[model samples]
Target: MKIKEGFVLHSVGDENVVVAIGKMTKKFRGMIRLNSTGAFIFRQLEKETDEKGIIDALIAEYGIDEQTATTAATTFVSQLKDAGVLDI
Candidate 1:
């Protein structure tokens, strides 16, 4: 349920654009591409440990209902898993 140890985040010229890096590679594989909202969720997951904490943080930060936030966070995490970016 968390990003793997060797991955890092970087910006591409503009601060708004973000990319992911995996260890042992000079060029990122570009397995996952995230928009600003997805990036926010990704950063939050980096700081938080579990699904509940992530859902709570998103709810507090975005002022959204628990169900809505949970749904979005769950979907995002699933996408990361499918992309091989997460170790959970």
Candidate 2:
């Protein structure tokens, strides 16, 4: 899966916020704030990828266990899916 087009991530203060632009503005008007972990996962989703790839990246970057990383990544991806911003 990958992030839908026109959704960009911006660094703001200590957080990363995602904003909609172009045609995406019609469906999603507000930005979504993400924590450090969410920001990392979002970056990975910038291109075509899979659940294992994302989970692996999270584990390598944060030194977290596979189970924990999978859970967090799953939850965040679900949020993007709910917001209609991911090409699942």
Candidate 3:
């Protein structure tokens, strides 16, 4: 999956957020604040990747095991899907 068009990630002050821009504003409203982990996941989703890639990324970044990374990546993907931000 990859991040869809019309949404931009930005850092305002100390907070990082993903905001809907251009035509995407019609479907999604408000900004989604991203913590460090969320930002990492977002960056990964910026490219075309599979669940294994995400799990590997998380493992490389956080040194977690496969099961833990899988759970975290799955949860992040679900959130993006629910928000209509990922072009799955």
The runs of at least 3 residues in candidate 3 whose Cα sits more than 4 Å from the true structure, single-residue gaps closed, are none
Model number with the top lDDT: 2
lDDT of 3 by residue, 1-88 (tens): 8999887888888788999989999988999999888889899888899889999999999999999999999998999999889998
Model 1, 20-41: lDDT tens per residue? Answer: 5455245445445577668777
Model 3 pairs whose backbones collide = none
> Which digits, one per residue and each the tens of the lDDT, describe model 2 over residues 1-88?
9999999999988879999999889888888999888899999999999889999999999999999999998998999899888998
Clashing pairs in 1: 1-88
- Residue 65 in model 3: shift from native, Å? 1.1
Candidate 2 Cα misplacement greater than 4 A, ranges? none
List TM-score per model, in order.
0.75, 0.95, 0.90
The whole-model C-alpha lDDT of candidate 2 against the native structure comes to 0.93
Cα shift from native, residue 8, model 2 (Å): 0.4
What is the Å distance of residue 1 in model 3 from its true position? 0.9
